[model samples]
Target: MSFILGFAGSNSSTSINYKLVRYTATLIKDPQVRLMDMAHCPFPMYSEDYEKENGFSNSLIEFKNDLQISKGIIISVNEHNGNPSAYFKNLIDWLSRLDRNFIKDKKVLLMATSGGKRGAIGSLEVAEKMLSRFGADITGTFSLPNFFDNFDIDKGILDDELAVEHANALKEFLAKITV
Candidate 1:
């Protein structure tokens, strides 16, 4: 089976985006999913001086390696103040320094979730625009709005209408990549 790497942009222990990604990962049948928790992959804040002095963190190197081996990527971004969360941006900054094309040639399913009605749309857009330039082959994009009302912590999506929408999006994503 093809190996797919999945992660959330947020590092929060109880991130809605993380739950969304994990639930989506379970729907794919052909690919074997390996979920990554950003909280575990700690790296120092990105800075020119820091890079020059300490070099790339081991966490960054390991993350890069994971991307290199994976056939596809699934990321659900979390928005903070209508933008990508600082934790996610920091990882991106460090990864960019290592290789601008770190996500090169991988089919990506870009997603996001939020408690608000917008569903972290801003952060998803930002990730889509930036990662595409770095060689991410975006297969599909999805967002779950009003996460608490539509999703259950253990049972996945709770609302039928929203669940169908998400399932269709995920189906399209898997189809495009697996082909």
Candidate 2:
């Protein structure tokens, strides 16, 4: 595997989901990892009219190119009223327009985290289903709830049990990343 791509659905600079994605990327030892914050990769909201008028933007092309070269991906999504956030949904819309199968055959470790107890599971579930349609081979999932209480800025996951679960999921994700 050349590199693993990691990103969160939320573009917020302070997003807990992005923190979780970064923590997960830290656990991987060998491969070159690119940890991207969605804030820096913004593109216009997708629309047929806009696409017809302007085609793919340079940012969208670069984002798709990153996906093309990645051997695996670690993604954590944010939730909004028990569904994926509109910002992330827009990102999906744009990426799909470029190529529905842009993520084809890529190994994926799906994850979610939030301040709430459900840990953004709603968005996680939705993304799991949606990513498969985009041709991601999802290998494992981990949800860390109550982010404030369960995670530390320097320490990563605080709960020992959840740490084990996260590690196991990451291990599985890494084992099959080259398949």
Candidate 3:
């Protein structure tokens, strides 16, 4: 079975982005979904000096390996000051160093969620533009706004309009990867 790697950009234990990604993964019927927690793949702050002083961390290597094996990816990013969360950026930096094309042309379904009405659009846009250069075949995108009111930990998306939008995006994503 083809595996799809899913992860949230935030490391928060109760991150809404995490919940969104998990819910998004459930929409894909065929692929075997593997949810990853950034907290588990810890790495020191990435810097050229740090890399020279200490070799690549094992966790970083394993993360890259996961990307290598997966047929597709689902990433739900968290925004901080109109940018991707620091932890997620750090992870990407390290992985980029290992291989600039770490995504390796795999289809990606990019998503984001936030408490504000903008739904972390800034970070999602940045990822869509940037990740493509690094070999991500971005198949689709989705955003969830006012996450607390629209989504439940147990029930998933509560808003019908938002749910339809999300479902359409997932359908497009599945078509791209499965074809």
Which candidate should be chosen as best, given lDDT against the real structure? 2
Ranking by lDDT: 2, 3, 1
Global CA lDDT computed for model 1: 0.88
TM-score each candidate: 0.95, 0.97, 0.96
Best by TM-score: 2
Each model's Cα RMSD:
1.2, 1.1, 1.1
Worst 10 residues of 2 by lDDT: 38-47
- State the lDDT at 129 in candidate 3: 80
Candidates arranged by TM-score, highest first? 2, 3, 1
Stretch of 10 with least lDDT, candidate 1: 37-46
Please report how far candidate 2 places residue 168 from its true position, in Å. Answer: 0.4
Candidate 2: where is the Cα deviation over 4 Å? none
Clash number for candidate 2: 0
**Superposition error at 28 for model 2 (Å):** 1.1
lDDT of 3 by residue, 109-177 (tens): 999999999999999998788788798999889999999889998889999999999999888888887
Q: Would you give me the overall lDDT of model 2?
A: 0.90
Which lDDT values do the candidates have, in the order given?
Answer: 0.88, 0.90, 0.89
Per-residue lDDT tens digits of candidate 1, residues 52-123? Answer: 999987778988989878888999999989889899889888888998989988888999999999989999
